[model samples]
Target: MGQEMYAMLNQDQRSIADTILASHRTQSTTTADSCFFIDGQGIYVMTVAWTGIAASLLPEGRTVHSRFKLPVPILKTSTSSIRPNNEAPMAPCYALNAVDILLRDIMNIDAPFGGKIMILGGDFRQVLPVIRLANRSELIAASLKSSNLWPYFKVIHLHQNMRTGPGEEEFSKSLIKLGNGELTSNEDDEIELPSSYVPTLCNRTILCPKNEHSLLVNEEALQRLPETEKTYTSVDEVECEDGDDITNYPTEVLNSRTPSGMPPHKLKLKIGAIVMLLRNLDVHQGLCNGI
Candidate 1:
């Protein structure tokens, strides 16, 4: 169905579709050899070579010698997968190594020539490379030093939590607190005080239950309020035994008539509510506080 829809798109839309497809194809082939290709006069060349040295040696003596040129634009953009082991810890080795190669060989070769380099992945908290550290203390010390090669590069930390919902935002905060051993009864009290604000708790006990007899459950419930439905009478009637109710419930009633209606449930601000404000709004005024 998606393929048919994609095929039916106009020329301008098809161009975008082609660009996306090409990007996916590029990402799928992850080796240094497979990513790059030579193009000239609307002709597509081969996409892979045996090795960097082999690729450098190709343009001069090969059968396609006249067809190609040296210092071929090699794209070392995407990286291959890193496997995890029981003995080692996680680190950004493959990514760093790729960057090193890009700096030393790819970028350095055939000087006086320059090209635009763009990096488009973030969400660093989501996934990191599984690296086997030979010396942990040394690596840590090296990472800390500003003079080291690691610090020479610029890093853009993305502040926006695009993937998470309101519930997820609360859960993640709780997890951070739990990991730091700062979660206490005081924090719980703060979260569950106001009647207007519902506390979003991270139920970590469900992560690993002690015994097979014990049942683990997630307590968070999603409230969904349809535009046609005014009041949510069903919220009170529904009873969840395992606490695994994943239905989105509409907590507050929305003004269906108004186009720019208020959100069903507005987050209540407390003393220590860790809130993320929208970038454009005033940080002091428009901040919606509460986890």
Candidate 2:
């Protein structure tokens, strides 16, 4: 969508789009999943992975001459009629935000006629837009507040998760944590070590010390288990990959007490329990026997 629109923009407009697009593309591989809005310039760009229907909807390509230029309005609204209060006058307004205009004029006709619009893009976790918002929430909030027509607008939530795998999941999680100021490491705590100390070669050296420490700890724990028979019984040994044996100590422990009115045999129970019962007089009085 953005690419087609970019081709129609004038030289100055193209320059602005190029600048914004370049900045986003250089950041990370995920840069492709970003949307851009140039305020005052009235230029917006969105990129999504190829969709046949969307491509078909785009205007047919034509040769570009110096005379060719982008449309003044991406979408234009029809003139509204006035009803007398006896005939109260109503104004025809167009949605400036492209997504809002697209949805109102195209996708969902039953959507509101005019109002402030909240456009949200979650491209960071999905396909990056051709142009990305520098600050998403702030820009959306500002756009919504700018219009007083309906005073309020519907919030459009873009739901798509394109990133997969544990590494990508962890990266997204870290981004969310950082946004909420819950990042584990503080800026001041980060230390710069001498370049020579950095490990360039990754192999057994990385695991050796840590593996030895784990083995020693396991051995010490196993040695103490036999003497503590009253608390622990039957220590089973399992070999681990790092030359360490995991000692599993099993002991019978009392889990829970019987319910107040339930008999011992009838009481369904377990250790670390919580029980809930549904409402019905014919049943066990809406109480959970064991939870």
RMSD of each: 22.3, 25.6
Compared with the true structure, the alpha-carbon lDDT of candidate 2 equals 0.32
Best by lDDT: 2
lDDT by residue (1-291, candidate 1, tens digit) is 667877776655465446534544553222221111111012233321212222233322111111122121222253322100110112233333333344335445421111212222222222233224636554443221222333322333333344467756776566456545566657445433233233454332245433222211211211222223223222222355645452533233332211211222223334332334322132123222110
Residue 179 of candidate 1: its Cα lDDT? Answer: 45
Q: Candidate 1: worst 10 consecutive residues by lDDT?
A: 81-90
Residue-level lDDT of model 2, residues 146-231, one tens digit each, is 43423332222322233445546655565555545565554886534334333574332323345446444544444554343222
Model 2: weakest 10-residue lDDT segment is: 82-91
Error of 2 at 218 (Å): 55
Q: What is the clash count of model 2? A: 20
Q: How many backbone clashes does candidate 1 have?
A: 8
CA lDDT scores, all candidates in order: 0.30, 0.32
- Candidate 1 is scored at a TM of 0.26
